[model samples]
Target: MYLNQHEIKSLLNKSFDNFVDFVNTLPDIRFTASPYGKWSAGQQLDHLTKSIRPISSALGFPKVTLRYFGISQRPSRSFDQLVTDYQRVLNGGFKTTRAYMPGVIYPSQRPALLQNFLLQKNKLTVKLLGWSEKDLDKYRLPHPLLGKITVREMLYYIAHHNEHHLAKLKDQELQGYTWQNQLQQLIF
Candidate 1:
């Protein structure tokens, strides 16, 4: 779906805010624990900050410079389609590149990382508001995993990506939810 600037802004704020709130409620140990050897919540937040920083910075570039990445000739994918495409890639075992990885986000780094995440998110929103609805569809950005996607699609991904990580964090809680419960649900 083609999201207008207003819709984009609202989704962006909602996703980031929800993630931050959830993280804030975590005790320091839980925040930094790597459940089932997956990334800790702190690492996930750091990764999100790293991923979003580039998009926010790129959006500040002049339109002409932004077009250096090339403009899209086709329509932007609906938000749902983009999310599905991302899921498909993930299911295909397309791992994140080192560039976007967060090595070791210590508990002490949590505040800085969260602050940076908010900064990037706010900058992206402001930059997006500066754009015309037409330009959003006209411009393209290079997505590391999805190749070139329209600006609007990038924004859609940003909104969903935040939620994606939150879900991963929640999934950790289910690790010890008990085999009996898992089997009962499957049997039912």
Candidate 2:
């Protein structure tokens, strides 16, 4: 339900670790593979990196300055509530905006991609930890799709957002996978 900073950080760290593990399972060639006109697995990873790094900087902005941007803070939402709301947004066809898109070119090296993902996640976790408990429920930022949410909800969203992308990646490949085949291929 309500997420304290330690619980939030632990959730993010676990989610990131799970994601990196998933990334390692994909064949190197699949990194660049995509349906006719879509982002490759590599590009999806880069897109996530692009999306989260800016939030780290956004967190650094003084509260008064953020308020000046006209994004008013809302009451903090529960973690479970955010997960449910996020799923609705996903099913509602919320798309990543053009500005958040990664460049067409992507790193071919799997290790490099993993490293980059881990680094950005670490940066985000550090930023999240730097906040006081009151700040978590006080400060707010404009989420591209969801608009203004408190810092706690934003962290909750970040954990779920990464899971969403990985699900999308799996969906793109599920066309060819039987349940057993998928189990054999997906290492968890």
The candidate scoring highest on TM-score is: 1
* Segments of candidate 2 deviating more than 4 angstroms: 36-38, 69-74, 105-109, 177-188
lDDT of 2 by residue, 1-188 (tens): 99898998898898878778877777754566554467767888888877787777787777677665454346688998988987888689987898788665444666777788898888888777678888778777778878778878888988888887888777766753556535544642
The estimated TM-scores of all candidates read 0.91, 0.83
Candidate 2 accuracy as TM-score: 0.83
lDDT per residue as tens, model 1, 1-188: 66788999999999999999989988776687665668889999989998998899888889999888898899889999999999999999898899998887677988998899999888998888789988899999999999999899999999999999999987775673667535634553
Q: Find the candidate with the highest lDDT and give its number.
A: 1
Off by over 4 Å in 1: 176-188
lDDT of each: 0.87, 0.76
